[model samples]
Target: MLCAICRRDARGFGFAPHLIRVAAPTVKLCSMRCMDIAARLKGMINPNKHEAAALDAASQAGGVYVELLSRTDLTTWSEQEWGRLVDVIVTEYQDTLRRAYADDPPI
Candidate 1:
């Protein structure tokens, strides 16, 4: 396997075992430094996935739960409708952040 960071040959690997022996798979790493670099690389490669993961982490940390309700079709909406939709989304975002960080003001 290639190093996720420098794209060279991997020197080591990381792993997490499942309930069964065959279910366990390895996570390859070129070095301990590359292990950290791999995670960072993953976040950069797919930010939406990382954002979901971060929100899940925030929930675990006692923050407000995050849920993606639905994907909207903005192109079909009229200008006024689009503005309304934007307002709703921005308001929801503010509410979620406020709940997530009650100690902070209007995050």
Candidate 2:
């Protein structure tokens, strides 16, 4: 499928969650870059140096993204950029839901 970001023949097999451009379509995409942020805010009030510390590295990078959001005034940005942002957000969200219910029976 085409990448929402580059519109190229993306490594992402289809129009899926910000399916990051990987080396190949056969490769699975990661939930880490996106979920690391959620995991941190969900409970980790502070950066943990414990077993979950590995997530801290990714979470910290996610934190930088958060900072970037607040640091910039989105209104001043162009519509194209905002639209692209929405595309990625929506894709990621759908992918999250799919994973969360993957093992559950459908009603």
Query: Which is the leading candidate under lDDT?
Result: 1
Tell how far residue 15 is off in model 2, in angstroms.
25
TM-score of each: 0.28, 0.32
| Pairs with backbone N, CA or C atoms under 3 Å apart (clashes), candidate 1 | 11-30, 14-27
lDDT measured at residue 28 in model 2 versus the true structure, 0 to 100:
23
Q: Give lDDT for model 1.
A: 0.43
Candidate 1 worst ten-residue window by lDDT: 62-71
Top TM-score model: 2
Clashes of each: 2, 0
lDDT of 2 by residue, 52-83 (tens): 33334335544455466664577776777566
Q: Model 1 misses residue 91 by how many Å?
A: 0.7
lDDT of 1 by residue, 32-107 (tens): 6546544433423232333344345444433221123232455655677656555554445434533533333111
